[model samples]
Target: MFRVIVRSSISLAAFAAGFPLSAAEAANAAATSEEDSIVVTATRAPLALDEVPSTITVLDKAAIDRSQDIGATELLLRTPGITVSRNGGYGTTTSLRIRGAESDHTVVVIDGVKLNDPAASGGGYNFGHLLVGDMERIEVLRGPQSILWGSQAIGGVVNIVTTIPEKPLEGSFDIEAGSRNTVSARAAIGGRTGPLSWRIGGQSFTTDGISAISPAFGGVERDGYRNRGVTGRAELALASNFSVEVRGYYSKARVNLDSTRADTPDYAFNQEFLGYAGARLDLLDGRFRNRISYSYTATERENYGPLRARPVSLEARGENRRWEYQGNIGLMRGVSAVFGAENERSQFRSRSPDASLARPLPPFANGKAEVTSVYGQISVEPVDGLTINGGVRYDDHDRFGGQTLFAAGGVWRLPTGTILRTNYGEGFKAPTLYQMFSQYGNAALDPEEAHGWEAGIEQHLFGRALTVVATWFDRTTTNQIVYTPDATCNAASTNPLCFEPGSTTVRTAYYLNVARGKAQGIEAAAALTLGALTLDGNYSWIVTEDRSPGGANFDKDLPRRPRHAANASVSYALPFGLDIGAALRWSHKSFDDAPNSIVLDAYTLVDLRAESKLSENVRLFARAENVFDEQYMTAYRYGTLGRAIYAGFRGRF
Candidate 1:
């Protein structure tokens, strides 16, 4: 099945590339204007998509509404060069990987605020709780973007932008119910009044989910999950050239889980709060623009064990606060300069009955760390149809001292409606507090470093009705952190390096920066629009190597990363205000352990959806997911959903 999908996608790409120029021009004669889209994640300033020398994928509001997926991670799974691993069904722990990089290597941003957790084991953001209820747009930038987005951008960046009021009076609501006794609802209201505009919205979701652990692992009880969230935004236009905006979001979730020891039940409760305030000012008659912003994020988690004897509970909390100022100035014709400075402080706290789980929090002892950074970027079009961009950043960490990073890229447009783009950049990630202060901590550990490059070509045909792109990327990392047992001690001999010799105690392990790794991949994507029909698809081929020296898994494929993956979808609009769509996803076999001991088989899934307009202000929709009921596992002992159906209604006023 995987091979068939790959071959079909390649054929589509070839067809788009080989189409005649005369035919394309004739077909595009009646087509609408192909205005270039603007994106802010590629650089600090807004730039046209074609001018940015990076691989970018944008999911706008229309696309989000059409998919009808309840979770944000489901929408991201279809994107090229991206993959997701979940321990169970929806609302469980979820991790995202870009171009075969580790989950922590990707950075997530929500409305100009970073979402990584300082208290988590690897300081990575969990996507399990993120829903697409009030999102206006999402931009995914592929490659090393640390120069512009700071740490944890070694793989890429996922920037999420929320909705704002666009009219004097408007609102929308949706209600849905599905398999496994699931229920979901969302509503939003927004309006503009004089110089002030405001928007507020909320969502509630719950489900009687399947067991998190597979029955093969001795699990039989159903686990349930519930989530609730709210978001708000307000903006004031103080003057013709200035504006102030504030945004806030809150979400809480409780989920029933299966214990690692079969048959036992566990539960987790989590909450997140995010706030942002910013002001934008236009100077020199709009040629010079400046923005100042402050953002804060806090997260808390609590877990409880099964009620067999006495319940065990664990609690953890983390917070991040940041202040930023950015300026963009039009220095000359076709040239612009962007500069910014930021100050950030992060703290973490944990409490548990077990001393090993809560010792040595941070501040090294005070529970906080501060970082200050400054960055500058320049964009220029020295010649017609050619654009160039360059940037540099310097970060000063209170404990790790300072580091400098640089990035450069260019985009060229050919007369044949072909675009050539390339980029190269550096990325680094500081040691996490847990890595530095835990029982197995290493205070002297150095930060991990990475550098990579990517090049791609995009072609537009049929008057922009058909578009195709292909890209190749390579990245290498040094000083990667890994846990290793005491080198001088073995099961047989104690060489004095062993903390305890001639005792039955387990040997201690420590985090070391002695590993190197590399990942390379090729991605191809195509989109076609004709009359009332639309088709989109993408394919990715990735190769990842764990080159850690003296390791049993040396030069082996990284865990949970499939070598092949593909996605395809088709949608059609009929004459009676009705639409229909179908989608297919496939993945090849992959390993579940670093030593390649466990194998997860290949699997394919199909989904179908339909919607009809009941009136100008109302619509009805339904969908069937995993139509074939294919059984698959993204993790070794986790259960996945089977065939499920849902129906819903949406209304606007």
Candidate 2:
């Protein structure tokens, strides 16, 4: 099946290249070089897209504005090598997987601050509440990036950069209303004065959503969600070669959810705060550059059940603090090095009352864990159009001793506008505090590790008006963490690992480093621009397997990862200051459980969008999601939103 898809995609690319299109028009549209796009996530320093040897995707502010997506997850769904599984509608629990890696294996950063939750299961960042109000760009670097990003980057890294003041004075406002009684509003203002610049933005989103659980499960309530967020940033230039920047973000959300039982009411409130401060300095006549930064993030969640009946509640909190220093130095022409050091600390706490016992239960907590790391990389160009990069890192954990990782890659560009790239890297993820100190935790568990490689080719044709890229990657992971039932202790045993094991109460599970997994995939993408019309598409074919003993899921396909996925989009600029666009997203069937007992059917979604320039500073836009209203599920028993329409207007000054 994978081979067939690849062949078909290649054939289609050839056909599109040969399609009758005016050469004059194509040349006019080819003024921009796709390979010249700048990205900062692949390496600590900014590099052109073509210079990066790994697979990456960048979405700039213009693309974000054109997509008309209010949530970050929605925008990511269109990218290659990405899959998102949401448990419900907007503001519900959402998981993002890259290259078939575990949700927690990927690192998420917003304005240099890590957003992973130490108290959450798997220590992953939840995308449910991440809005797109103040975003400037998003860069996704795929593959093992631990040499630079440290742990939890076994899959890749997602860096979100927010907007900063670029003009003396600038501001914008937007308001939108949509189906299901949804409303959203956003506003931003920013300006620069002398050597100082600052920007501030806020957003509010609310929706009367659909049932989180499918009707077949007896769901009959109208779940709803509300979210508010604010962002601020400031920068100061103290000298000609030195500058300081500070950023802060805060978001709060309230969500109504279906209860475990049909008769009960359930709701949750959550908040997140992120802060960052950094400084940059240049010395030795710009031959040496240095950066130092500090970041802190905090997350809190509260859940209430049956609000009318002495509502029982649970509260949880997580925090992370980090400090880092990085440097770049030029030793000679075409030869440079990048180095960095970082220290991080994490904490988790949770509290809940026992409703049945009518007393406060003991709080679960992990005091703190610390990790220190140092890494360095060198990029050398021995010849024209040929670049090579190699790096290594060492991480010391307060409780787990130390580990080292290495990576190497290179890019070679041919004179014919053809590029060849290859990369190999190693990654490791330390156990989270919850995984190590919780009730079912195991202090003896070792960190998970992965090694991977990728090779790709990119070609530009038709005066660079069309670009095609294809990549193949493979990865193997060892010592993966899994929960297993204790065989030595059964129903009557007093062992903590087997609470009423054989009985109906609940089986106790303990974390174990006993799993091995492998994932391999092919990704193909193409973009074409012809005068006022643009077309883009991508396809992904993945095969993932788990080899874990002591469980029924041995050698089974990973859950929630489909074998095939594809996306296509088209947009056109018409006369009279009008624009129109359409997109299609499709995924093959996937299992919802490790054992493959529960199956999620294949699904396809279509969306349409249109916008008109009402005036030089005012624009009107509208979009329709799930235009065909297909009924399907990405997760078992979770309901998906149906057809929805939204209209909005924007004003800039």
The number of the candidate with the highest TM-score is 2
Question: What are the lDDT figures for the candidates, one per model?
Answer: 0.79, 0.80
Clashing pairs in 2: none
Residue 9 deviation, candidate 2, in Å?
Answer: 25
Model 2 residue 100 lDDT score = 94
lDDT of 2 by residue, 115-215 (tens): 88888768889999999988866767789999988899999887786666556899888899999999999999998777877889999999998888866
- Model 2 per-residue lDDT at 230: 97
Question: Which candidate comes out best when scored by lDDT?
Answer: 2
TM-scores, all models, native as reference: 0.90, 0.92
Off by over 4 Å in 2: 1-37, 260-264, 307-310, 485-496, 499-507, 549-551
Model 1: ten consecutive residues of lowest lDDT: 11-20
Error of 1 at 151 (Å): 0.6
